[model samples]
Target: MQTIYIDADACPVKIEAERVATRLGVRMVLVSNGGIRPSDNPLVESVYVASGPDEADKYIAEACGPGDVVVTGDIPLAAKCVAAGAKVVKHNGEELHERNIGNVLATRDLMQDLRSADPFRQGGGRPFSKTDRSRFSEVLDRLVRQAKR
Candidate 1:
């Protein structure tokens, strides 16, 4: 069975992902440390892992496999899920797979190194916008439909 695994910590599109999963009749697992309200929908499952960095990521990477769709912004976690044959998508609608995971990881590492090299460098991405939300919904819907096949 195809499932949607969401790395829910700091995720901006939880409700959108849930809507897509529910509409597609796919099981959606929200992994986090805490602070997430449990969903009443049977198709949605809220999984709270131990408190720590990457605990939720670890769970998501280990649990997701082929035929699963993983939603995460952590590049390393996305790489792992892609390696495990799961389709990975970022909150902004970027799809990570075999074709580009290497470059994505390398870019992420380079950015981290550059940030570490400069103490004054600001660390943050652009704010989430309405366009991003729309793109995420469309991409998620498409991925779920593809996974169902």
Candidate 2:
């Protein structure tokens, strides 16, 4: 059966993903490093990994496979999931398929390089907006339905 694995550390659409998964009768696993409260919903399982970098990401990557959907903002993890044949979505609902994964990965690496090279290069990303959340919900809903089939 298809499952939705969420890299929940910095994800903003946890609740939205849960709602969609519950409605679609799909299983959703929220993997974190222990700060998130476990959900009471039986369909929603919270897997708290050891406190370390990429522990949750490793777990999710190992478990996810074809027909599985993963939600994450980490570009490396997204690429891993995609290579494993799972469909991946960003927090803002951007789908990262095989066709775009390479470009996305390269861009992310480039951006990281720029940041490291320029310590004074200020400016965090924009705050997540309602429209972004709405788009995520819609895209997640569609992906979940497709995975079910």
Candidate 3:
């Protein structure tokens, strides 16, 4: 059976994922580092890791394999999932595949380096919108169906 793995520490699409998973009768796991509430839904399980940077990401990556769907905004985690043959989708609906994972990781690292070089340098990111949620739902449905096959 296929499972949906969510990097839920700072993910904004947890509710969206749950709605889609419930509708599709799919199992979902939310991996966190001790901040979110545990889900009461029988189909949804929460796995809390030790409170440390990247602990949740490590757990999520280690737990996922082929035929799994991982939702994460972290570029490195997304790359890892893609390399593991697991389908990866960002909360904003972008699909991460082998073709683009390297570029994504490089861009993320470049931005981090730029920010670290200058304390006052501010990195800009767009806020999640309803349209993003809709796109994610649609893409997730498609990915889930593909995973099932």
By TM-score, who's the top model here? Answer: 1
Q: What lDDT tens digits, residue by residue, belong to model 2 across residues 1-149?
A: 78999999889999999999999988999999989989999999999999998999999999999999999999999999999999999999899999999999999888888989999975778888999899999999998878777
TM-score for each candidate, following the candidate numbering: 0.97, 0.96, 0.94
Q: Count the backbone clashes (under 3 Å) in each candidate.
A: 0, 0, 0
lDDT for 13 (candidate 3): 89
Candidate 1 stretches with Cα past 4 Å from truth are none
All models, RMSD in angstroms:
0.8, 0.9, 1.2
Instruction: List per-prediction Cα lDDT, in the order shown.
Output: 0.93, 0.93, 0.90
Candidate 1 TM-score, C-alpha based? 0.97
Off by over 4 Å in 2: none
* Model 3 regions more than 4 Å off: none
Residue 6 lDDT in candidate 3: 95
Worst 10 residues of 3 by lDDT: 120-129
Error of 2 at 98 (Å): 0.3
